[model samples]
Target: MSFGIFQVPPPANEPVKSYAPGSPEKQALKAAIADMRSRTVDIPMYIGGEKIYTDKKHRLAPPHDHRHTLGYFSVGDKGHVEQAINAALGAKEMWAAMPWEHRAAIFLKAADLIAGPYRAKLNAATMLGQSKNVFQAEIDSACEIIDFLRFNVHFMQEIYRQQVASAPGIWNRLEHRPLEGFIFAVTPFNFTAIAGNLPTAPAMMGNTIVWKPAFTQIYSANVLMEVFREAGVPDGVINLIYVDGPEAGEVVFKHPDFAGLHFTGSTGVFRHLWQTIGNNLPIYKSYPRIVGETGGKDFVVAHKSADAKAVATALVRGAFEYQGQKCSAASRAYIPSNLWEEVKNYMIADLESMRMGGTEDFRNFINAVIDEKAFDKIAGYIEQAKKDAGVELVWGGNCDKSVGYFIQPTILKVEDNQYRTMVEEIFGPVLTVYVYQPELFEEVLELTDQTSPYALTGSIFAQDRYAIELASRKLQNAAGNFYINDKPTGAVVGQQPFGGARASGTNDKAGAIYNLLRWVSTRTIKETFVPPTDYRYPFMAEE
Candidate 1:
């Protein structure tokens, strides 16, 4: 057998199609959801290609209607985590030694599977499990996942092709080598795309992974496992476990083979892991790479000359989509006092028009929050705002938890920019607004920049060119993903390269080349054209 020089095709974002009523795509997805909901799926831990069923099981239910049971996934403890870690280590050498082209082909095949046959299945899983509407599922589980796989493969190729410069007498070749040991991927419940990407991104670079998905997202995670197996990813290359945070960390952090952690979840969890790793540094063989994308207190600031209608629309879509569970979801806003009345009315009109219910109904634009805990936390804030004289509940102060974890799209009107609602990350469909004097644009811009500890995503709306320029320069470090005249939420792959800094995460920029760099260590190979048989040089002889 012989090999040819490899070339990667240009990467492009997957086109998102609307699953509107009476459309064939809508019919197919509805059918998929029906089929999935009709049966109770039983999920087990996958270690070294073996399906291990634990004695303990946890029931899975949709957040929209919590009483109905959709499936059950096996509950794992410390022992299962150990088994998963060992499995990843067992497969490390072979996977790392495999030809780079073969490794790339596996994820490419998975991308094709997601784009075609598995599209409806995964999208339906996300809708039922995560309470996302039809469009949300399409863009998240289907389109974004496809883009991650394809673009990551292209990114891996780019890393591999990068070479060190060579002198005349020596040929220097650079090799991008995978980490020496296994990686741990702790993914969040919001995006099924992130769930898939967090693990597969490092695996695409030939490193083995022990993946632990958020309990709320196991339904969709199981579908990804099937896709990977169907696409022929080798056994033990990427192991899936169902252990919780502490259980997984106890086993993974203590192991000498722990080489990296790819995380996308709460900031608290990532920081705890960092602290644990730091305290136990002496036991590990190498300093593990910690890459995490965490919580965000995202914002949108509008200048006096900004278009009222456009600003209102941005707030509606950016803050309410996916029930405002996204890390990049806009939770705070700053508007000049002059335009506040008009913008507030425009926002209220949109909020009143939104219909909230189960994602099975395409007419419903908003769905429930993930689970009971998230529901209670958001409800508490709305209740507090109702009582506090410093703040007023402008819209959506209602919440009902009898059938599902549902909260209306709420907006809080506050006089203080330093209010708790403006500074904290609610991670729900709650937007806190601070109306400022139009003349204090610069001062309010600085206040908005300094309000939150997180610097994830932010936006500005302005018709004045100089004002826009001033905000842009002043708020440079305020967000990793900044938007002008657009919402910060719908970041596309290859185009936006999503991530953020300080408290939000490491800001490696997922779906791009920078993220792939964290997974591999480079080695330089130098070959001398002429061998120096003699030991001494001219300078040494003269000396």
Candidate 2:
């Protein structure tokens, strides 16, 4: 369709705005938050160019201030799921046939829109709805999402430029076509960038999508949809539906036109969806592409030669940021006996100085958990650790949900390396530390590798090169996004392509060309200049 090979505009990571005192960004975001809180808006499902609103409404409230209602989203059932699928399928032909340059332009424009006008609005929505502080919301909803949009366009162009080499008198061409049908994107509540990326990534490769954001993230998701519409994304290309998992899954998984699934959520849910897809393989027109990034019992291990202060800082920030709701958040740690004392003191001091309150307050380092269920689950772990003989409740185990779902940053020091808190994926601000003999560094690495079924993210802290190498070699398979002396979370879009294997879901690294390849089915064409008139070869004549 194009006369010449085209290059997409070069991409750069969006600069993260520091909402410091007296800053314009700070004032703008605060005004947006105030504006959003002043009124309760009605949200609708966007399907095939239509904003479908149903009678079944679900009220959305902030996790840090549960009583204050933000807005209400129209909840749909399985029928709406079917409608979303049909819409995606209906839009597939036109969307796919559009020139790739045009597609790239749309998303690039979307990035500009997000980086400019929609920045404050998106950040405010995330702060109010998902209870992320200003910085967390800025990095996630604004900067990260902007990076995803811009970088993905460049990746798409890179994919198309990849072609097979042709010999003399013949032309070889490679065509990267979109999936046969449509993609179904199921995103989690923890990340706004991820929610936007899941659907748009596939759509950028010319596929249509039915996107289902987490119910708790609907407030911010609606803002993303607004951005998409403003950026000129055609109707039915990416349909947004608000529906429960089971009802949506039953219809989506069973549909023959379901081309692929791009997901981010729990390990359990990913497994269930994979099983359903496998069982329904016979009904599908083609083998559906399954891609997911799931749960993690992420870890932070410090060697005897590691700096105590640095290790403490990593644990405090990596484990407690965003209330430890991130899948890559550090949940467990193994500290050498010689360094445990100093690390403990530093961690305790940091926790003591931290404040816990709503997201509006900039001084509060810790906020409430996502919802009542998450709060209770985290609280249950803290309460159980208090009673367990193998673990000691070292710092911050107070759980008071009277006003909001607030649980203090809790820590458990365990004698047993395989203690419940150490092994389980508690998606909250609960960290379990186990002290090991200084000589047993290698042994502790082995234990860490085998303790958790997840292999999402983990870090090793060591000033000694030999110790770092040893841990890296020993725990090679323990994490997909392994760190040397840094925190496991805060993966940038283009720099660190994220995802993990084992119980953490498929390791098809997102934020890279590798992920874009999944949404496309390539076709190689060989055109010969000269025709073969004879049926027999030269060897036949010799015979």
Candidate 3:
């Protein structure tokens, strides 16, 4: 069925009233307030040089409290996805042939526009659409988008300027070229920054892109496209579509023009895509590039020497940021047996103080889960854990889905790693803690390695420099991004490349030069000064 045929209704709840003037919550709500003051733009699906509005509409509601509808978005389906891919294919040659400097300028302009006019709106859309708290949404959706754009522009310039070394007696040079065809970028809903990365990275390298954004965050994705268009990204260079995963994956994987697949989602989907591409290799026109960041069951290990308060705060924030929906969220934590009591006390105190409410309430720390399915999934996990043997529900079992999908911040103490709660990824504001003897730290690490099929992100905390160094080296291969004394989620773009290995991902760090290199193809150019005036070789001439 086409997306145009599915008409979503407006949210049932009334609009939220403005917070009281001069109140503490009001002051804390600065970002949301600034966002509300900004203009609300209507979103349209961009395809084949046109901005199309559909009769089918989807409401964008705040996750914290569903009562507030942010706006309505146009929904696109399978046909729409195909059209977008076709458009990207049609524009591939012209865009790929464009001067590198010119393309960089366009991207830079788009970055400037996002930083200027679109900042607040983008933040607000993220808060309402994805359910991020004001501060988190502002940084990820607004600031991070601008950062990625600006960084890519600079990186592209460097790529263009780089030259190959000349051999002592050879007159040959190597040149980097754009991919032969269009790239398909399938992004996730957890981070708005991801929405920008899928298209911008490829476009910066002169490759046209067909972007299939997550349905839940279509409004924000649409706004990002508008910003790009306004910045002079030519028609058809970047095409945006809103479609469900399976339908879109089918079209993208089977298409002849699909040059690359940039994905960030579940491991199962990534594996399936890999297998499907493998099966299609014989019939495929060319070898397509596959880059993905999949699932993660990140962990934080706290040694006896670690600061109990600091570890507790990092664990809480890392586990609950964006309601713990991120792939890098801390799902499991290991504590030394001797320090378990102190860490537990600190964690409980920190979590208890966390204000639970809508993002509109500035004082609120933890927001709601994305939707009803997410709410139910998390609730089911918590309920199961509660009844499991030797599992204590430290906090949170409440859920209020009236306004939006809301789940209380939950923590569980598991008697052992054998419990499902310790191994699985909850993907909510839920954390499972296990205590281990300090001397068996290595053994505990081994246990953690086998706990999940994923090996994405993990951290270790200790005051003993030698112990920390030993653990860091031992766990080096276990996590894609390892932390010394901090959380794993807030990876900076330039310094540390972000991504996981094994089932977690292909380890293609999003903001690094390595990631940008994947979007390009290398070409060797050689010119002969004299077009072989004689057919005979030098040895024959001497004879």
Give the clashing residue pairs of candidate 2, or none: none
lDDT of 3 at 441: 83
Q: For candidate 1, lDDT tens digit of each residue in 374-428?
A: 9999999888889888898889889999998999999999987788899988999
**Backbone N/Cα/C clashes per model:** 0, 0, 2
- Best first by lDDT, ranked: 2, 1, 3
Against the true structure, candidate 3 has what lDDT? 0.79
- Each model's lDDT comes to 0.92, 0.93, 0.79
**Model 3 Cα lDDT, one tens digit per residue, 10-90:** 112111224357754335446554565354445778887898788888776666656665567677777888888888888
Candidate whose lDDT is highest? 2
By summed lDDT, the worst window of 10 consecutive residues in model 2 runs over 534-543
List residue ranges in candidate 3 displaced over 4 A: 1-42, 168-170, 530-543
> Candidate 2 on 32-89: residue-level lDDT in tens?
9899999999999999999999999999998988899998999999999999999998
| Residue 209, candidate 2: alpha-carbon lDDT | 96
Deviation of model 1 at 201, angstroms? 0.5
Q: What TM-score, over all chains together, does every model reach?
A: 0.98, 0.99, 0.91
Q: Looking at candidate 3, what is the lDDT of residue 406?
A: 78
In model 3, pairs of residues that clash are: 66-403, 66-404
